[model samples]
Target: MTPADCPEKPVVDLRSDTLTRPSAGMRKAMAGAEVGDDVYGEDPTVKRLETVAAEMLGKPCALFLPTGTMANLVAFLAQTRPGDSIILSESAHPIHYENANLSMVAGLLPCVIHDALGKFTADQVEQRIVREDDPHLSWTTLVSVENTTNRGGGACWELHEMESIAALCRRHGMRLHCDGARIFNACAVTNIEARYYAKCCDTLCFCLSKGLGAPAGSLLAGDPETMHKALRFRKMLGGGMRQSGILAAAGLYALEHHLGDLAEDHRRARRFRQALEAEGFEFCLPSPTNILYIRVENSLRAVKTLKRRGVLTLAHGQDQIRAVFHRDIDDKAMEDAIECFKQALALPR
Candidate 1:
């Protein structure tokens, strides 16, 4: 159903940060954005956004794509050959959430490392590395990591750990890629700069639609040569766009205005976590950013009960519910959400 068809504005929408609609200021920017064909590299606004994104990530170049999944696919396609293998945390978005694009589209094999917190040490990477002498194994070519890991309750990878992993990849002649969909959230909470995290990877991409509140788009950044190669894969994957500056303008506005406000979302999420904890709710991990996963007796029933109370959340698993805070949810909405949870807990199974 269309947004206007809803009975009323939701008291709180913890389903995902992607639910955020463009703000008036962002809409104004989109309306005034200049137009050009991006496939031809002539879109002035898109170029500006790419440049800003690259500088922010301390990369030599950046390419804007329609989605974070596409950005990741192109990075893999550019970095690995068809028979090569890549290593990733088993809980990564590509493994569970991206429809197996790494295997289906990129034709790459995956070496999964199971980790509850969505992070694995350099030692784990070494264990997963295939021996080159064993011709039976697919050559491990790339290592990918996610920041503010989605399924891991928005856990951020420590910089030292990332540095160790990057060093290992370099030593093994492998490329490092970062699925930095929530890199800004990590930066906001840890007081680390985006560049430091970007520097730990051979290529990295961050979403404009998630915490940034843009209508659509993600930017992949890396060295110029690799990005040039990725550009072709982007088009091969049908990601080429014409006059995408309208969307890029929203990304630009988000970068300029919405970035500083991410801490507020984190604060709200923490407050929500505290309230749930007080109600005897259990979480898989600490809420470091805007995402939290609460353990419930029956996730589906809890979600239904919360919805009946004008609150919205997602059933993450049979017994887990995921809540994500964003620009759209305010302090009042958060309190209402907490109260709704309390009420849901009081209901009979």
Candidate 2:
């Protein structure tokens, strides 16, 4: 059908899943949440959220932070000393999205491994490890991996590979951390429980703001000793909250009600990919989760065009436009998006 034949619809927002607004149920939970000063460790709702997150992830302890960035950075700060080094993929979030916090705040050296899919083998990490006898080199103290890597088009790392890396870190007297901001998405695709992934790392975090549909919050989990240190670093970084149980309440609601439907987002993503392919468009890579990267000659031009047609998206780089699916997008938005894509592709070069 042509533009005239399509029904009127709200804007199709495929820019990022973080754009998802809190659902009514989540808002209700937030409204009714028990509150106290979390910094003083008196918040009942925050405690419950942390307890539930720790149990589900199989970590002995958990801490609630305002954002995933804080959770990831606190983990790094807690596990390593200043001048220590970290190993992470070129596409890891801390490398790009965290505004150089690892260096400026944590004061650690970053040793990067390049992988287009945002995965590095245990062998790659072993090669990056510094020789302790070499007094001139900073010690490699930590290795971090992203699950459903953001800049890598939401790619998930294999559990076996993670186990290998964890073993290698243990042998080298280093810690393994998973930047699992979208880990639940990985779980949906791989049929793996969050606890198994937690078992492969000394620390990891997952965001409720992204696919979980919370307005704001992230949980960092690890062994009690590491998490004890992490709590101190979180306070140092100003992550202590006064009454964040209101936000934690949304997280609790999401975990209880939203997890089972994540696979549906994956299905919609696949359907969107197939639909776009039928229009002669191509994705930069096939993602198993909600994120998709469409290849275009000029990403900026395509983004502007799609925006004018009432479909919102992000430009991954110079040549790829990214679209992410979340609970906010529905069948109507998906159909409208396809129609807009058909029209956008018909534009004069």
Candidate 3:
């Protein structure tokens, strides 16, 4: 007995930008969706969505997954065996947010490097790969990169730099995996097609529920062999859902309409940054994508103040906060949030 994936759809939830409910057309499509049990690979709608994603990403195959974390874990499990090592930035979602699921599922070890700007060059990646002569070390078998790196304030990787890193990985007999959860935002901000970004990685996962405004789902794309492996791993993780077309419908709707809206999100983020600066709040770095990090004195108090004012954001640490702009957070919310910041700063220091 499986409960329908979209039992209830939210309309506007900007807390994480993943709360966006399906659009009206998406709901209608989901209600009348063509579905089958996905465990047997017989779900026509799921197959169609997978095919569409694969073709869009220039990959031979793709897997529809229940969540971005599962998509990333499945790819890692397929790429690395126990005791194999992989290099990734310290800010990678897999390292900080996935609760060590990488080690749990793939038996993979992490070699972390700091990437303050969210873009790691070829030299940085090559430096992390252990040399063949180093017998005392674990073999570095994979290089993982995150686009619009969450901790880097949604920064994007340049295409040329990524190509260079991919070539470096190939020379070392290492595969490259991209955790591109907000890749559509990257694509929208950079004005680049998604396939061009896919060219630099052996496998990649992108979320439909994030900036794309889908209710639930992410996609992992790769060559045929890897994708087949991922499909099997997906089921092993108990992610096989019946009638998943309800979720797939929203993904399709997002791909069609919401991709362009990410630029608007970026615009609003820039506006918010300007307002924050006007109130004497400085940024640690430039706001590139829809995510911006604010350098503040009392992070927790600021969060509480914003929450009280009907605004929501995350407190990263004692000195910094993260404010994410999404399609649902319009200009008015941005202004209200800025006022909240100013009011919070005026509190007893």
Among these predictions, the greatest TM-score belongs to 1
Against the reference, the lDDT scores of all candidates come to: 0.91, 0.90, 0.82
Clashes in predicted model 3:
0
Q: lDDT tens digits, residues 1-349, model 2? A: 2456222653898988998899899899999999999999999999999999999999889999999999999999999999999999988999998999999999999999999889899999999999476878999999999998888888887789899999999998999999999999999988889999999999989999998899989999999889999999989988899999999999999999998878888988999889878778888876989999988889888887887778888877899999999988888888888888888866344
**What TM-score does candidate 3 reach?**
0.93
User: Where in model 1 is the C-alpha error above 4 Å?
Assistant: 1-8, 347-349
Which candidate tops lDDT?
Answer: 1
- Give lDDT tens digits, candidate 3, residues 51-117: 8899999999999999999998998888888788988988889888998998887888898988687
Q: In candidate 1, how many Å is residue 286 off?
A: 1.5
**Candidate 3 lDDT trough over 10 residues, lowest sum:** 1-10
lDDT by residue for model 1 (1-349), tens: 2566333867788899999999999999999999899999999999999999999999999999999999999999999999899999999999998999999989999999998889899999999897486878899999999998998889998899899999999999999999999999999988989999999999999999998999899999999889999999999999999999999999999999999989999999999888778767788887699989888889888887887778888888799888999999999999888888887776343
What are the clashing pairs of model 1?
none
Spell out the clash pairs found in candidate 2.
none
Each candidate's clash count: 0, 0, 0
